[model samples]
Target: MRRFYAILVAAGLVYMLFMFLGTIVPYGKADVADRVSAHFLAKDVNSISPTKWVEGDKQVPHSERVYGRKGFEDGSANVVTSIVVNYRSFDTLGEVTVLFASAVGVGLILGGTRRMKYGRKPNFILRVSTGILLPLIILFGIYIFVHGHLTPGGGFPGGTIIAAAVLLLYLSNEEFSLNMIVSKSLEGSMGSLYVIFGLIGLAAGGAFLFNFLPNGVVGSLFSAGVVPLVYMTIGLKVGSELSGVVAEIHEEREG
Candidate 1:
């Protein structure tokens, strides 16, 4: 019986090795960088021309219009930013929902068994320092999300900053427990509201995630109709999810 089990394990390992080698055996002697450059150069420059797409669509694909070029059009100056907050805003909303779900899963797996608290209480020096730094971190996060349409930062980066602040709070304040109910509830509510708003846009404008509000003058604070709003929702959802994950990990470790 022992020999049979060993033989089976060896056979499985051999099979996996063959499968791994098979994937690499078919590669041709081609320069990967050259292939990438060729693909990049072959693209229709006129269609993806930054100036044309960002300034105003003379002739560009609808996918690019809705999901690619909002940065230039809205003066955000970052293509990825425009994509997340404006063009593919609905996808971002979905991503937040996935984050929320992951947080819940982590909580259920780790938080259910027992609740334990660890780490030392913060000394006076640490407490004072955190109190000073917390507000600044939060302010910077807000700035990043708000300027997403006109600058380099956006929801994900900003949300991460806010999450860091929450972690600091957990570390510095030993007695305080993260309010899981409030955090998860807020995440769910905001994520749902984001989707509902997108659906409303679809119903009214005949396009999902359509910028129902006036496009406004390009490059201005109020310009990218729904971009900032979507970004704010994303930031909130991301912050909550990340904080929840951290809390779950802390609980697991304590247990």
Candidate 2:
């Protein structure tokens, strides 16, 4: 009986997938150039462009978007950003949730406020150099996530970079410790803000994580509406969460 139900669910999913695919191009007609990439490139993600069927070709493909076009489905110059933040933002939310869960699991296993147990004290050169370079690394991480709508980097990488700075501190200073209360507060705030933005979008635009803000120039600092904001939230949340996790695992267990 369980097997029968599983088969039924699988079949239903496959049918839905097929229906989705058929809407992309056309039934029984395949156009390699007119695939999903074309829609992304053309900034036609939110709605289907007009289709003109011909004898040989599957459909008249939508022309790729000219650079810096305004008032499209999304205002991001980076096609990947548009897809990730606007077209399918729910998946990004899931990714953040998974990271949060991992952080929680790590905290559960290595639960303590004990200090790190270093083998030897860090030298002056190592300490001084880190002091000089730490701020730069953290700033670079901020740049990555903030410019994620226009550049290659995004929240995950940016947050990881910031967390790396925290790790560097631990390595350089034996007594360095994070205040869990402050860290947890920042983490919770950022996570809540991410969802709050999504909920606000749903109220205004009838879609969760909708790009609710005004569209600015493509490739500009303030463009892509909620993407930069969302990425910023993700960066802070991830950096704090990972910092907590790293701090936890580094602690000297009170045995």
* Candidate number with greatest TM-score: 2
Candidate 2 lDDT tens digits, 42-116:
454323466432324444433323333344345776778777877778898898999999899999898786896
TM-score of 1: 0.67
Q: Give, for candidate 1, the lowest lDDT window spanning 10 residues.
A: 36-45
Q: RMSD in angstroms, all models?
A: 13.2, 9.1
Clashing pairs in 2: none
> 178 in model 2: Cα distance from truth in Å?
0.8
Can you write out model 1's per-residue Cα lDDT over 106-135, one digit (the tens) per residue? 877877433346655577787789999999
Task: Provide the TM-score for each candidate, comma-separated.
Answer: 0.67, 0.76
Residue 250 displacement in candidate 2 (angstroms): 1.5
Global local distance difference test of model 1: 0.67
